[model samples]
Target: MWHIWTLDDWEKNIDLERSGHRCGLRLRFDKEVDSEVRRACKEFAVFLRREYFFPIRVVIYVKARERIIAMDGDKCCGIFWCMPDDYTIEPYIRLAAGDYEKLCKKWGKDSALTNILLCMAHELTHYFQWINSIKLTPIGKERQATNYADYVLEDYAETREHP
Candidate 1:
């Protein structure tokens, strides 16, 4: 099992000086998960930086799979890949057939920003797990991924309420 506190530690270690207004988050989930998922994540990351003063660049890659596999014998689902230094948003946008102008029109600037922040936080949490040498069976990793997604959604809602 991976430690959840890894995310908390990353949050604390953020270097505000290097953080920027834009994030290049990538998701590696099923392509069928909804085209908006990537958009939401990028927007939320932007929101976190703008509102909380923790600027960051989040790049996401959403990979499509025929079926989710379990890391172990457990019932977890979904997998994510992330890197701290590789914050490039262009590739992901191309994969998802998305553009900035369309997102801004659909979600509004503020909402889109917040969505990116949320996604970045979630993906970064996974990166933390990887960096900490946390290992999860296939099933366990899948479960963690599912839970992480839910947590991100909840966090986005909370942020919106208070922001």
Candidate 2:
């Protein structure tokens, strides 16, 4: 969970002690992750707190990059049905980079940064669902997250300059 914020990880929490707009969400990643993905993680947390009222900790790591773009590793709370204290967001950083390269070739206009931002946004959408009480079928879940990502990307792009 978010308590995985070791002393090293807790370094980011310094911002939490600041005056205004400090996010409760904590994002941690391994050295294997690149700078771009790291920046995206920070920005995504800010977006959630500001736009959607979700101030949750999200740990991003690179233990796996083969099977999926990203997966939320927060298992069900053992005693109850709620999510645990922190959210484990295992973003397949290398895989996202690969997807960005391939998608860039096919799309011809989007940048590597935007493509990966989309991936991160998609995973965060799942996070939003996990914290809420709504339930959906497998296909329904995918559609909701995809739609949430698409709408947020388009709207946020139009409204502000995203990193």
Candidate 3:
């Protein structure tokens, strides 16, 4: 059920930044996903490029699971993870597809997409923390990511609400 995207899978219209989007994104989906999921993920990729200033290829594993939030390794592997920690270089993001559906049911389609966007932002925060964890304790890293996710989500909502 996992799919990989290289140059072969690159869509012509996909917006990869020139100067900063350095990471070669390798993706693995537990099942088929939509264009919005891909798009939301690319936003995270862009964030990584602009923020970290390093070229680290990352694999994202999207899965359909019940009641589980997203995780960025060092945590429970969701439903369909096969490999161990060795495969975690640049580390893979495990996103909860069921959570997306829950957002849709509770809010709406737009809200669901935004929820995924925030989740992506959240996981990206984890990646940065994981890489530069020397300056941060375990609790501090989690706190930073959580605060970052909340701040980004609020900013995003405000932008959409006004614009």
Candidate 4:
């Protein structure tokens, strides 16, 4: 069972009052997740939203399972679901913590938390592209998202190192 998250549920609502994007972030996590995973995601979501404005309000659902079938029926780390024509419908990003851990091990990521940030960054990039009406072939979009994710992670690393 899922419910709207609150300040008592691990992370406080991100203070986007001055962001000027009229955006908000809502998060829901399955009961199976540990606090560590939730914390990493919440923190990274804040960083993403602050650095790259959300085109609209967004919800992020972190699933417990290791894998999920995308609309195309392919297993993936995460997905950004949106209908380009209907901005009124709140878009959401779905990520699986188990899959993040597995991918971290498989791809030699620094850690699962880092993998989580990278995957979410990828999905968020897709969200931006969708809202901005950027058209690309499927492969091209994937490449762009991948590049954006890398850039985000690198930028995040810089912030941590300097601050």
lDDT, candidates in the order shown: 0.45, 0.47, 0.52, 0.70
Residue 55 of model 4 has an lDDT of: 43
- Give the CA lDDT, 0 to 100, for residue 56 in model 2: 40
Model 4, position 26, has a per-residue lDDT of 69
Candidate 2 global CA lDDT score: 0.47
Scored against the true structure, residue 94 in model 1 reaches a CA lDDT of 14
TM for every model, in the order presented, reads 0.39, 0.54, 0.56, 0.76
What is the per-residue lDDT of model 2 for residues 1-163, given as tens digits with 9 covering 90 to 100?
Answer: 3111111332342234452333344554555555555666567557655765443444433222323422364331110112333333321122234243444467643355566556556666665555443368868867876777677777567755654
Model 1 stretches astray by more than 4 angstroms = 1-39, 48-58, 61-79, 82-125, 161-163
Candidate 3: TM-score?
Answer: 0.56
TM-score of 2: 0.54
C-alpha RMSD for every candidate? 9.8, 10.3, 10.6, 9.6
State residue 157's C-alpha deviation in candidate 2, in Å.
1.0
Q: Could you arrange the candidates by lDDT from highest to lowest?
A: 4, 3, 2, 1
Assess candidate 4 and give its lDDT: 0.70
The model with the greatest lDDT is 4
Q: What tens digits encode model 1's per-residue C-alpha lDDT throughout 43-80?
A: 55565445332123334444332223334533222234
Rate residue 63 of model 4 by lDDT: 90
Error (Å) of candidate 3 at residue 42 is: 3.9
List runs of model 2 lying over 4 Å from the truth. Answer: 1-23, 62-110, 159-163
Worst 10 residues of 3 by lDDT: 2-11
**How does candidate 4 fare on TM-score?**
0.76
lDDT of 2 at 28: 48
Worst 10 residues of 2 by lDDT: 75-84
